[model samples]
Target: MPRMLPPGVGRRLRKGERIVLETHYHKTGRPEKDEGAEVALYFAKEPVEKMLHVHMLANVFLRIPPGSREHKVTASYTVPLDVTAYDVMPHMHLLGRRIAVTATFPDGRVQDLVRIEDWDFAWQETYQFKEPLRLPKGTKLRLEAVYDNSA
Candidate 1:
């Protein structure tokens, strides 16, 4: 289920804008059919002041050999502006073993954002922070994913 934004924060949709839905499907041994996903966009009744955006950190050209125990891939993004991050979602396929996200502030201090020692594709979901985290401009956000492609 998608989360709702707090009051005074909302995303504006332009007329005739395109919306894309990304879905992840898995097989359950038995043959089955997928009925697609249902999405709902709620309009704000009150005034909205903030707009929301999504930044993807991806290494799309990675290749891992079969039977590899611990193949690692990493990606990073530098923050161009100061912003508040409230939710984070990490994605990996079935062979994923672990994943971690960290941020290095401009002052050279590194902070652990999120880490999963054991990663399972079936249990993946968006993680909402207890409070919004402020990321300063020029902060480096790094993501490292480990894969165990052994059968």
Candidate 2:
């Protein structure tokens, strides 16, 4: 006979749950430019544990055409998580403006994990949740970040 499994081992994320986030910039878009931008993540509002070195990730630079209203980029990764309070943030160069983390469920229900309207690459920090979030096995976490590459 097969061994019995633990309870709640494969449940989906429920309402009022919290999550932690770890982010890193693939690379510095402008290595020669000293006046560009820098990004990093922090835990517990402190710049120490779980910090990701930005240069380890890929980076790209672009010059948007005038009168252009479209620029899109996507990065995907799986975060190993347990039931705990957490926050999400995206680290980017000067172009970063907004960051959105969404949790999609198998039942089609979507949850806004976290959002930062004004993204400051200098003050990059992952705002932790006041409460721990419980995520079920079927939970699908996604991140969407918007940037303003124009200087």
Candidate 3:
């Protein structure tokens, strides 16, 4: 996912700075073949006022029955600091059927971040919001994912 820095923060890679990158690939039953992958980086022409941050929402302890058609898993995290959310990414395996992410304010107001009623593993993507979502401290971010494990 790519994001532009919000307007007075300037980020520069210092000399000898170490950057870590991670990638995941699906395995097919066929023999290995040569494949190409690349990552592109863009720099802003001027300085920005706010820095962009990526927050990962994940559920790692998913366990579904062999014939389950609508197994569900939920995870939540509380915001430790005030932040502006600019994008969302939902990740799942082939069994995933639906997913949703939402935010509950401390005052009891609820806001939908993103929702996918029909999830396709092949078309997974990151959705950028038209306008940044302002999340105050103490807001709870909840994620619910549904999966189908039937043969």
Candidate 4:
């Protein structure tokens, strides 16, 4: 788990469900031997009222020309049902400088879910909101990012 959840909240898991873990090993320049690893699973002691789910938003298509700076990338998604979002995580690779996620309600109300004016790929982490947002149906999510391809 990247971050611990608050009490009474946990990842949804059904009875008799088996968790499949995936591991990625990188090649080192020098000779290396395999080391042992382990993972721990913790369940919520209290009844779970809310489940945490991760949804990734990404734009794979890009056409950044050589020596381009401030390249803009955008993507959006609409919610079909009501949801309460308590955490958000925005990711970008090298050359990314800015990113912002916003929500526009049906009634023309706008809310900033997450915004990073100075994006650093090394400082990626989940952001826990102090107050969970009640995103009603028909909420539109918009993501805009700026990348520097000047190199």
Candidate 5:
């Protein structure tokens, strides 16, 4: 079933409550960069407090060749409240082998939100957190995803 939003969710996203999606790619031995990584953050039909799901969309395009060395791609977003389990997953091309998510708080407490070690590019599935992870107010939600670009 589609979710229903509360009174003032959109205003939050538009009013800087929404975190800008960022991408970072690391090349084997060379300097790290954000060459061709793509990141998309989508809100559920309802706000984080109302909906049972938070849709996260991530993608990466490797500018370098496939077989030189493995590369890592990362994407992140932020929510108004400390997030508690709303379907999280990473999206990548045929080179993607693993995806992991980490939520870091302002106090430096880190939580492993989700991890997909042996992901297949052909079959992408929505990852559900075992339990809802709660973040307190004034917390900065950090989600980091890694991708492998290998032949």
Candidate 6:
């Protein structure tokens, strides 16, 4: 997975620091070739203006019944500080059908962040805002995911 960092903010690795990487692999019955992977890091030559933050919204207690066609799960987070949102990413397994994210301001204004009417596990990606979304403090971020568990 590739992520975009906020301006003027970067991370440093201490000497003798070790990083661990993990991946989830789905098994197929056919023989496959495994190749080595590579990682690339980018740095800005100039000073950055703002720092980036990552918020992971997930529902871990899912209980979709067998043969059920539309199972929904929702989660929300409140913004404690004013920040500009640059992108959003929705994640789900093979049973996911749709997903949406929205923001509700303290003043009662609501904004749609992202809505995927059709969810595909094979083509998940991050959606970037055309312009950064300015969210004030006390804004509530909501995420809803729909799944199909039919046999």
Highest TM-score scorer: 1
- Extract clashing residue pairs from model 4: none
Give residue 37's lDDT in candidate 1 (0 to 100). Answer: 83
Candidate 1 C-alpha lDDT tens digits along 1-151 = 7688878888889999999887777778898888878898899999898888888887999899988999999999999999989888898988899999999999999988889998988867888888898999999999999998887
Question: Candidate 5 residues 1-151, lDDT tens each?
Answer: 2332344333234554656645433346777654665555546565444434554534344354556445666556655665445455566655666667776676778777667677666545555555545666555544444444454
Ranking by lDDT: 1, 4, 3, 6, 5, 2
Per-model TM values vs. the true structure:
0.88, 0.48, 0.80, 0.77, 0.50, 0.81
Better-scoring candidate (TM-score), 2 or 3: 3
TM-score-superior candidate, 2 or 4: 4
The most accurate candidate by lDDT is 1
Q: CA lDDT of each candidate? A: 0.89, 0.52, 0.83, 0.84, 0.54, 0.83
User: Which digits, one per residue and each the tens of the lDDT, describe model 4 over residues 99-137?
Assistant: 999999988999999999999876476788998788899
Model 4 TM-score, 2 decimals: 0.77
Clashes of each: 0, 13, 5, 0, 0, 1
RMSDs, each prediction? 2.0, 14.1, 3.3, 3.9, 11.6, 2.9
Per-residue lDDT, model 3, residue 2, is: 56
Between candidates 3 and 5, the lDDT winner: 3
lDDT of 2 by residue, 1-151 (tens): 1222233222233478865554444445666434544444222332333322211112245344554334555544333443332445456666667777777665778877777777777756655565646656566677666766455
Q: Looking at candidate 2, what is the lDDT of residue 129?
A: 60
- For lDDT, candidate 1 versus 5, the one ahead is 1
Q: Give the lDDT of residue 80 in candidate 2.
A: 48
| Position 119, candidate 1: lDDT | 91
